[model samples]
Target chain A: MSKSSFVAEAVKKYGQDRESLMPILQYVYEKKHYLSKEDMQEVAEALDLSSADVYGTASFYSFLDTKEKGEKIIRVCKSISCDLKNKEQIISAIESKLNIKNGQTTPDKKFTLLETNCLGWCHKGPAMLINDNVYTELTPEKAVAAIEENL
Target chain B: MSTDKLQKFKKRIDLIFSDVNWKEILDKALKTSADDIIKELIASCIRGRGGAGFPTGLKWKFAAQQKSDKKYVICNADEGEPGTFKDREILDKQAKKVFLGMAICAHTVGSDEGYIYLRGEYKFLVPQLEKELEEFHKELKAKKLDFKISIRLGSGAYVCGEETALIESMEGRRGEPRNKPPFPVVSGYLGKPTVVNNVETFVYTAMILKDGSKQFCELGTKDSRGSKVFSVSGDTPNPGIYELELGMTLDEFVELFGDGDTKAVQVGGASGFCVPRRKFKETIIGFEGIPTGGSMMLFNSSRSMYNVLHNFLDFFCEESCGQCTPCRVGCQQLLKGIVAVKAKEKPSKYLEDLKGMTETMKSSSKCGLGQSVPNCFNSIIDNFKEEVIY
Candidate 1:
């Protein structure tokens, strides 16, 4: 669904109460990959809120992106638990394979490289999250393979 | 039931419902005017219960002081400490209170957005919170309120419970602590001014705002005024959440649940101090205990202090966020020293090295995860030298 339609549906479901905008934005972003200005405006009107409120909500949450959408997302676990397990090596391995630095989306927009906090599986360590699914006990080869599989 | 057992159960149940007037809680949180809401919080003096004990009102004032067009509030529901479960209780029994507190905080901080970043194993709370949040949003919309909140779940890393790490995880990045020249108060979440508070800190705010600061202050100690919820697990008769005044002694707390079999009460969680039985008198519930605003697990003669320290070290070794070298590597070195000592590989000979590493971790680590990494071990060893030597 388009971002506008998603916002329209959200406004229909959760009309312009300023507080409902966060969840609405989260739902729309998850669905359309990014929240557009139109989506933000539609959300503002529905909640009887200003465009600023809608934009603030979107920018406040890391999960809700207002920028141009990426094709693929990469989240590495670089917290202590994962670090102890050699997450750095895995990060470099992915960087080498994709020929892109962390936080940069690939030229083709096929990938967005990012590091995630903990992601909760520290026992397994050296973990990475692709979109929502988590990949654990990752080595350089595993990191490359995981990226390739997603590609 | 014996009078003692009956009283124990009564105390436990009372904590969940005790003195907390639900109607007042709802009324105070549902204020139509932002000034009334901020006034209520200012009157509460509810400080952050997550160990720091900074006044909640002041924290809002700091973030609200900034003239940035965008601001944010984060509820640090990530209770990943080994023995802490109070966050789960507040989120479970008082999810509305948690949500309302977040709204009040946002309104007070001049932010239109809020997030409750909970640890992952709290899967049980997700659906419960989702339903509660759905209802809250409905009611809020019906009133045309402008702020909104959401629950973000964390997987399992204990360090993720730290504010910066929590922010990193929320941003879909690795849970490492950012340097503090720009604390979360200045730049957080999506690089916005954010205020992260514990579940108890927020819940208490709902009450304190409803009642007045003088009323909340009428309860605990002078410096630490308020009732604190303690888990009181390990070697206790009734191992559960207990609410007590800030000045309550550790012995008094132990007597409430420990049938006199208590050897030591691990005041605070694994990251807190290990007050030995002798120094029990020194342990008070509030700031003195370094509550971590978490549960209190007790240990008796059956558990060795040495073993407890060993296990806690293992947990830290495994839970560091890996960005800083001291904590990521120091934790492992401390654990290896413990193992070698256990294997009779060395005696107190390695104690100095471990102590040196512990000091380095306490002083140099980037985040709370690194700084607090050696707290439990240091407390145990410093207070109970004989235990480790043996």
Candidate 2:
């Protein structure tokens, strides 16, 4: 099915209510990996909200990506607990293995590494979330091995 | 001391996944009058476990008295507080009790629909939580209960942890906090009366119903009653969840969780205060001293006080919703000012000016995010002046 049709179907499931905007965006992101301008326009038409409104709401959240993104997103927790556990070592390992900075994606568009505030895994620090799966209690070596294995 | 001694010093509520008869409590709560339930909650003196410490009974009373046909019971499962993982554990193990508490609240407040605003980062737990909800729905159906609940996922915003901002996120807008006086109890969730309580608060509500309110009230201090689940992490040999009596001193807590080299403790999360080792003996963990929303992070002597304050300020800067001026600019200014001072580009006297700016941010900012952002900054600068300046 077309991406527009898929998003339109998702919007229809929640009806034309404005309150369904966040869920609809979430659905589109889940299906497409990132929200595009076209997706926002489609959602705007379906929900009777302006494109700017849809885009603004989408941009406000850290998870919803409007621009092009990789297939797998690796979010490193940069908050205090993870920081205390030397989260920088993990980030450095990923950078060395993937050859990209914290906010950069691989040249092949396979992976995107980003920094995020607390992933709620403070007890098991030095944590990172690759896509939806959480990998915690990470050492630099474990983080690199996990990324390489995924690749 | 060994870890066993530390374990013995703590109190465990055991309400979550305690094999309690939850269905019986739900049935009893359903049959009980709303007024009587509110009275029981009042008698228990249980407050909102979501860090605000607002009286849970008064919140229910306000929502129940709103005279609206449409009301809502929201379980604020958006556990975004850094170093606080107790809610995640509760929701994982005792989701049934959490839902039961919501149903009880809905029955009292005359609402039939509910929502759990689960955080975005914990989206991985959604399938498991939904499965639990499905089982709960079947049980509710068998009992012929009218209340139903649906899950809504947050999209990676920490400001949504605030009640008003959470309502906005549920409505599919930017997660910006709304103004008060028309609080959630009066105007919430599409301007209808809504009761939003923390995950732990609702679980405790169900537990209170299962055990009499008097028994629960007998546990803690006069001001802060009952047991609290704390998320302890950092510089501890065993870092995880612990349920303890509400009014334990920091000295006792340090003995249990703190390492020998522990220098300071962050009572709450990013928005909480920091207590140095010297003050730990006098500090209490309840409302009378420093009220926390279940975060107890220990920093050892090796950890720099300057870096700790810097990390928290950076978090506030990124998480602020930018709806209000003071919080938006104040956070950035504090972050920049601290960096400049540390770099020695700005004089140490400049910190006093920044401290005054924090006072303005606290008084004039839009929401709790702005108002409380200065807590760690003020506490750290005041307590560790030498470390911060030199």
Provide backbone clash counts, one per model: 23, 0
lDDT of 2 by residue, B139-234 (tens): 888888888999999988999999999999999899999989799999999999999999999999888887879989988899899989899998
| CA error at residue B283 for candidate 1, angstroms | 2.3
> How far does residue B342 in candidate 1 sit from its true spot (Å)?
2.3
Docking class of 1: incorrect
Per-model C-alpha lDDT, please? 0.71, 0.91
True contacts kept of each: 0.00, 0.93
Query: How would you encode candidate 1's per-residue C-alpha lDDT over B1-390 as one tens digit per residue?
Result: 233753764563233334465445655566635566555566655567776677777677778777778888899987766556677777878788777777777767788888888775555568779998888877667666577897766655677778887887676445667888687878987888999999888777776667666777777776677677765555655655656667778777766766577777776666777777787777776764555565566777766677777767777777776778999899888888877876779887787779878888899999887788677878887877667777
CA deviation > 4 Å runs, candidate 2: A1-3, B10-12
Best by lDDT: 2
Query: What does candidate 2's lDDT look like per residue over A1-117, in tens digits?
Result: 245776887887777798899888998898777999889988998888999999989999999999888989999999999999999999999998999999998999999999999
